[model samples]
Target: MNINIKFPDNSVHQFPRNTTPLQIAENISSGLARDVITASVNGKLVDVNYPIQEDARIELFKFDSLPGKEIYWHSTAHLMAQAVKDLFPEVQVTIGPAIENGFYYDFDKDVPFTDEDLEKIETRMKELARENLEYKRREVSREEAIEIFRKMKENYKIEILEEIPPGEKISIYSQGNFTDLCRGPHIIHTGKIKAIKLLKISGAYWRGDARNKMLQRIYGISFPTSKELNQYLVDLEEAKKRDHRKIGKDLDLYSISDDIGAGLVLWHPNGAMIRNVVERYWIDKHLEADYKIVYTPHIGKSELWDTSGHLGFYRESMYSPMLVDEQEYYVKPMNCPFHIAIYQSQKRSYKELPLKYAEMGTVYRYEHSGALHGLMRVRGFTVDDAHIICTPEQLYDEVEKTLVFSLDMLRDFGFRDFKIYLATMPEKAVGERQNWDQATESLREALHKNKIAYEMDEGGGAFYGPKIDIKVKDSLNRLWQCSTIQFDFNLPQRFNMEYIAPDNQPHRPFMVHRALLGSVERFFGTLIEYHSGNFPLWLCPIQVQILPISENYEDYARSVYAEIRQHGIRAEIDLKSEKIGYKIREAEVRKIPYMFIVGQKEKEEGTVSVRRHTAGDLGSFLLQDIVKRLKEEILTKK
Candidate 1:
């Protein structure tokens, strides 16, 4: 029998049934056959060697594609596991999976894997790849799978086998002397992986549960060419230099102290100044956008959480309740409940529909110590949260406006590149199907209407509703999820929220929860990395630094500082008797945007030598003219 296969270019071809995707690629061109790593048969990803059984749409994936990379890294993980097992007979493989950048395999071993062991593993992986081992898959019954693992004395594999449903197909893949249980569409052969590198090794809990035994996890990356691998390594090194934790400490922006508790950030004067500027700008923007800002308590009664369904659905991340006058009060994990309360305060009418309430609400959440990192993941942080309660007719417009506002704000902060994701309802979600569909459509329309390109994340939305998640690319080209515009049909219904309609009947108003900067702490962390400590003039804590060449020029430096400060520029004088070069170097290290070097010539001429950090000297300018240029640059946020 012959089958019709539709290519991505809309070309249709007739081929015999059971013809593999690789054969199709070969028929097209030998170059394509060599380049194709995987294929999607009727939208389901499969190996390039997968047989074409019926009429289908076949999309071949190259090494550069996301699915292709995932398959490549996943196969690399198996290769790594095989190498580890070959080196250490006693080591047991628990689980291994592909991450965003690479892959990691966790091992249940007596001793931790060392750096020396990593070198051995990489050597073994390369040797194994050169062997050109074929990956063959076989399906087995659940009992057969259990028996196979039991014979191998792999307890982790047996435990995994027990979780498989009775009638489900249990597939295992074998390559060379190594065989493992996997549901895979792996590469046809190990030779496909050419260049391999073992990045690092770390400790991880079995299945991410701290209660489980700790396992040694080895991270690695592989590429078809050595050039790609080398480039990736270069990016990794640059990423370390831009690490927010290191920059945060170097700049004295923020700190996480053991005494204050982990995952809790203490912003120093420098960080606080930046935060103040961001807050002021945020408030001013919200006001201009016709959003009424509000303040809510950090703790709310247990009854309030119950009404919001947080006690039922989101209790795990919430802190334990405290008893106050026999009533339990819980630290707020979200500001939605309080916003709902405000809506319910008065009997709202249709005239009051589309009410927008914004807040820099601080909320607490219980984060695992192992999961916490600098400001990105914290126990307590302020969310740039807002709720827009509007009529169903106003939902689309509000969502579109919210998206536009979010992009404008992010752009103002120097984020030019953005990737938007429209996340739809998940399998376990609240709200009616109609409400979910309406919410998802609103987000889709918003992105489409704005001519913004986005990817659809099916079943990746919050339990309450669908959302538009905007991930901004930093200076390192790494994506960070910052803004979210979400709909909340569950909360409004749970709280029995209603408004008087035009027909004089009570109706449920649609609620939208938006966080332009998801969290102030996380956004600040991203900004630190994005700017690499050299902030824009308008956002810099100290816009200008006055340096005196010697003790004789101290008076002139002080005068210069005073003059700049009078013009509302954040100016500081380095009054210490340090050498001019040393003072200038210190100012540059501090990432001060401008340094006014005052010396004998400047003191006599009543002019200052201006030096821009990272740009070197800009010659000498009169104090008044320099102030005008500085003000203009700062105002323009250049």
Candidate 2:
């Protein structure tokens, strides 16, 4: 029998019924066969060695592609697990999975892994890789799989096996003497991983449950070539230098205190200034764009959350409710419910079909102590939210407008490169099929109309509806998720939202929950790292520093500062007894956008010598001329 294989470009070719992906690649071209890492058979990821049994859509992946990299990293994770188990006889492995940039394996060990232990384990990995052991897979009945794990004393694997859906095939992979229970499509051989680097070690709770025993997690990355690994290491170093935690502390921007508890940020004066500037501009632009600004309270009754279905589905992430007037009140994990409450407070008509309610609301969620990062992952942070209530007839236009506005906002903040994703409805989802189709189509058409390229995330949407996710690429070439325009059919239905139509009939309002620079703290952190702490002129907390060459020019500096201040520049004057070079150096250290050096020559000439950050010694310019230029840059966000 013959089977038809469809390529990603919609071309089909005939092959034997049991021909493997590798064989098909070989039949096509030798070069393709050499580079092919794995193939997606009928939308399911499968090994290159797996036989093609029928007509299917096949997309072959190489090492550089995202899917291929994930598979490659996952294979390396299994290799690492093997090495660790070989070195530590008593240690039991839980799970090892691939993550962004690398892979991590959790081990049920008595103590945490040390540097010396990592060195020995990594050495063993290299030896095993050199042996070129082919990873062989075998299918077994569920009971037999359980028996295998039980004999190996891998209790974690057995627990994972118990959770596997009934009728799903249970498979085990073995390379050398180590075997693991995984529904895998791993690399052909250990030799494929040519370069390896064990990044770090950390403790993770088993299955991410705090009540479970903490396990030692070893994080690492591998590459097909040594050059790629070296470059990644260099990028890692650069990332450390640009780390927001270090930059925030050095600049005295913000602090997360042990006293105030983890995950709550204390924004210092500098950080607060940055936030104020962003909020002011945000409000101004929102008003210009016709978004109605609204304020919602920090806490809401448990009944409110219950009605919103959050207490049922999202209780784990939410903090315990406090007693308020004999009722349970929760620190809101989101602002959508309150926005819905506002809409419910009054009856509406089609004339108010597209009402956009915007808010800069602070909400709190319970993040485990281990999960809290500097500002990126926090318990409490302000979100720039906008909920649009519109009729089905207006959904398409509203989504398009929101997309344009979101893109514009991100660009204004100096983000040029973007990674967009159009995520469609998931398997277990709410809403009618017609509504889901229309909502997904609206998002798709908006991207197409804007000529924006985006990847399709199949079945990756929220249970409520489809969404468009925007991730901005930072200077380090790392993608950070920022803007989102998510449709919510579930919320409107749960809240019984309604707006009268022209025919005098009540209809469910289509709800869109959107945000740009989603979290203020996270966005601020990204901004800090994006510019490497040297913020752009408009966004910089301290825009200008008036450094006098000496106390003789202090009066001149003060005058320059006042003029700049009048022009609405964030200016400051240095009056400390320091050398001219020292003051200039200090100004640079502060990452001030501009430094006006006033001396006798410049003071008499009615000018200040300019020293711009990133470009040293911009020469002399008239105070009025410089001020005009500064204002333009700030206004234009240059």
TM-score of every candidate: 0.82, 0.78
lDDT tens digits by residue: candidate 2, 368-426: 88778888889999999999999988888889998999889888888777889999988
Each candidate: what lDDT?
A: 0.91, 0.90
List where candidate 1 sits over 4 angstroms from the true fold. Answer: 1-75, 90-99, 106-116, 129-175, 179-195, 202-216, 223-231, 426-430, 456-460, 473-480
Clashing pairs in 2: none
Give the least accurate 10-residue stretch of model 2, judged by summed lDDT.
472-481
Per-residue CA lDDT of model 1 for 175-232, tens digit only, reads: 9988899989898899999999998888899988889999999999999999999999
lDDT of 1 at 214: 94
- Per-residue lDDT, model 1, residue 540, is 93
